[model samples]
Target: MQVISITDLNSVVNPTRLAVPIDTEQQHFQLAMKQTCMKLPTEPLLDAHPQIDRWIMEVGLLFPKVFEWEPPQFLVDTQFIAKLCTKKKDTCVQINTNAVFHRNGYVNLIEWAIRHPVLNWSDKVKLWVATEYLSLPPENLKLTILALHPTHPGKRYEISWDSQQHEETRNWLVSVVTKQATPMKTPVASQVKSPFPVTTGADFDIGKIEEIEI
Candidate 1:
C-alpha cells in the first residue's frame, strides 16, 4: 500500500538503534542490515479474500510450502506486509529489517496478509491465517500452503516429500492439527484467539525494528 524508496531509508532506519550489535551477532545482524539497506521500491497490501476461510481449511490439508518454502524472515526481506485489525488502528504486521515488532503491548495477527512481493492472493491469505490464526510453525505452515490445489478430477496429492515414506507428511499433519483443541475462526474484523502463543522467529526486542518502519 505504501511506497518507500531506497534513497530515503537512511532517514527512516537508524542503524545505531539495532538490538543486535554487528560484532557479536554477525549473521543475524548482517541480515538485518542487508534487508534495511536493500529496501524494495514498493510495498503491496492485499485486500481480504472473500473465500479466505475456505482456503485456510484447504491449505491446512495441503502442504504447499514444501514446494516453495519462504520463511517469515524471507517474507520480511521481500517487504511483505499483512494488514490486520481495524484500518482505523493502522494495525498490521510490523517489522524492522531485523525482526517483527510488538505493537500495543502484544504481537497480533489479524485477517489481512501483510506485504510480501511474490505471493499470490491465495498464498497470501494462507500465510496470514497460518501465522495469525493457526499459529503454525514454519515447517507445519509449508504443508498447509499446498492443500488448495485446483479442483480437477483425478488430481493426485503427495502425502510425503520423501519418496520412500508415502504417508509421512500426511501423518505428521494429522498429529499437528489434531493437537489443536480450538477451532480456527473465520477471517473477520474482530481478532480471533489463537490456541497457542504465536511467535514468528522474526520476533525480537521491539527496538530492533529501527531499520525499517513498518
Candidate 2:
C-alpha cells in the first residue's frame, strides 16, 4: 500500500457526496437488525460496546448499499450487527459516530477494529472509521485509518512522493472515498498529533498520521 495524505483525499473526494441519504429499505433493515441483535446474548456484541451504537450501526448497515457492494448476511452466532458490514468478504469497515478524544483512545479503537473477530483479523483490509458528527452536511474534522497492516494498526501510512506505487495507492484510495461518501474536512497540520514518536531508519514510520479534531 502507498502512503495517503489528507490533501490527496480532498482532491479526490467530494464532501457533498460523502454520505448519501439513508433510504427507506436501509432504515427498515437497520431497525430489524438492531431488534434481532438486541435479543441475542453474545460476547461480540458486548465487546463491541460504544462502537456499537445506534448511528454507527445504521451506517454499518447502509455501507454496502452506498458502496454498491454485496450486503453481508446476518450471522446468528456473532450476534453483533457490525459483524455483517463486510465489504469484499474480507474487508471490514467500521464507522465511528463518536470522535476519539485522546491518542490512546484512538489507538485503542483501531486495535479493537483490527482484532475483533467480526472483522476476521484480515491484514489486507483497511478499516475506515468515519469519526464525524452525524448531522446533515457533516461539519467537523473526520478521522480516517490509512494503515495497510493491522498487526501494528496504529502506525501511520505515509505517501512517498517519488515512489512508483504512489499512483496505485492514490487510485485505490480515490475509489474507496468516492464510493463511501463520508465527508472529510481540511486538517490543520498544527493541530493533528501522533500519539508516539515515529521510529527512525524505516520509511513506514516516517510521516505522521492525521488526527481527528472535534
Candidate 3:
C-alpha cells in the first residue's frame, strides 16, 4: 500500500530492535528489499520474467540462511502443486534456502505484508507463512499484491486502499521506517521511476514494488 520512494529509501532508518531472524546483517535486509524494488521489471501489466528472479534474489540476500531452491516452487498448495508439478512428480517445494529454515525476519516480513493495513487480503490467523512461500513462489512484481500472507487456510480477504487508506499505509510506512525498524531513506524529492505500470487507477497491487540503484 505504501509506495515508498525508491530514492528516499536510502535515508530512512529505524532504531527499534528488529526481531527478524536473518542470515545477513540488518543492513542486508534493507539493501535487498530496496535493490529488489529497484530492479523490478516494467513495461506491461502481465510479466514476471524479471520480477520473480528479483524476489528470489532479494529473499536470498536478506536471508542467506535460505539457499536458492533447486527446483523453485511457483505455487504451494498440494492440489495446485499436483496440477503444476513437473513430470518428476516431486511433492514438496524445493526451497532455495537450505533445509526448511525459519527466521524471525522472514516471519516479520511475511506478517507485515499480510497485516499491512494497505491491501487488506489476508486474515489474523497465522498459518505458517513459511509454507506459503514454499507453496507460492511469487512470479511477478504485481504478485506483491500477495503482500498479505495467509492467516488461516479457510480465510481469504481482499481490500483496496482509497486515498485515505493509502495515506494511512504510507504514513504507517514512514513510522515503521523511522521508529519501528532500522531502515534508511533516500531523501524526499528524489527523481525515481514509478514501479507499477499504468495502473489506470486499478483496484489493487504493484507492478514493481521495490527500489534498485541505477
Candidate 4:
C-alpha cells in the first residue's frame, strides 16, 4: 500500500481551491473545508451541507409542482413561500403534511436553484450581502436591510451593541475586508483529475506511508 500527503491530493484535485495548506495539519484541512463550503458555487450546496439534500428531496416530494415550473418562477414562488413560512410559523404545515420549515429559510431557495439549472445562481449572492453592508458596523445592522424595499417606509433595524462585542466585531470585519481586497495567487501546476479518494482526519500518521497511489 502506498501513502500520500494531503498536499499531494489537493494538487491533483485543484490547488487554488483549498484555503489551507494541505501539508500543514489535519485540523486545518477541516477548517478549510468549512470556509471553502461558504465560498464555493451554489452547485455544491448539497456538498457544503449534506442535510440540504434530504431537505430538497422532501420538499420536492411534497411539492411536485415546484419542479415542473420554470426556474425563475420556481425561485420566486419558493422564496415567497419560504418568507411566509418563516413569518407565519404555521405556513409549512399548512402547505403539506410532509412540509417542514428551516430557520435558515433561504436555504430552500438555494436548493431550488441547484435543482433548476436555468436560474444560473451562484455564490455571488453571499458576496453581494458582504459588499452592500461592509461599511455598516455589525452592532447596529438589522437582520436584513428592509429600507431598500419600495413599499416600506424608511425604518431602520437596530440592535444593542456592547463595547467589547463592538470592538471584536470591528476587528473581524477589518480582517475580512482586508483579505478580500488582496488578490489570490494561483498555483503554478495545471489542474488535473484526482486519482485517489482524498480524506482528512486528525489521527492519520503522515510518515508511515511510502507512496500514495493517487
| lDDT by residue for model 3 (98-157), tens | 122233222222211212223231111012122344342222111122232122111112
Off by over 4 Å in 1: 1-76, 95-126, 129-194, 198-214
| TM-score, per-candidate, Cα-based | 0.20, 0.20, 0.21, 0.20
Better of 1 and 3 by TM-score: 3
- Angstrom error of the Cα, residue 61, model 1: value is 26
Off by over 4 Å in 4: 1-59, 75-108, 112-175, 182-214
Better lDDT candidate (2, 3)? 2
- On residues 36-55, what C-alpha lDDT tens digit does candidate 4 reach at each position? 33343334445665544444
Compared with the true structure, all predictions reach lDDT values of 0.28, 0.28, 0.27, 0.29
**Index of the highest-TM-score prediction:** 3
Residue lDDT tens for model 2, 59-160: 344232221221132221121112122233322233322122233323112211211122211111122222211121112222232222222223222211
Candidate 4 CA-lDDT value? 0.29
Please say which candidate is ahead in TM-score: 1 or 2. 1
Rank the candidate models, highest lDDT first.
4, 2, 1, 3
Q: Indicate the worst ten consecutive residues by lDDT in candidate 3.
A: 75-84
Model 1 whole-model lDDT (C-alpha atoms)? 0.28
Any residue pairs clashing in model 2, and if so which? 3-158, 3-159, 18-181, 18-182, 19-181
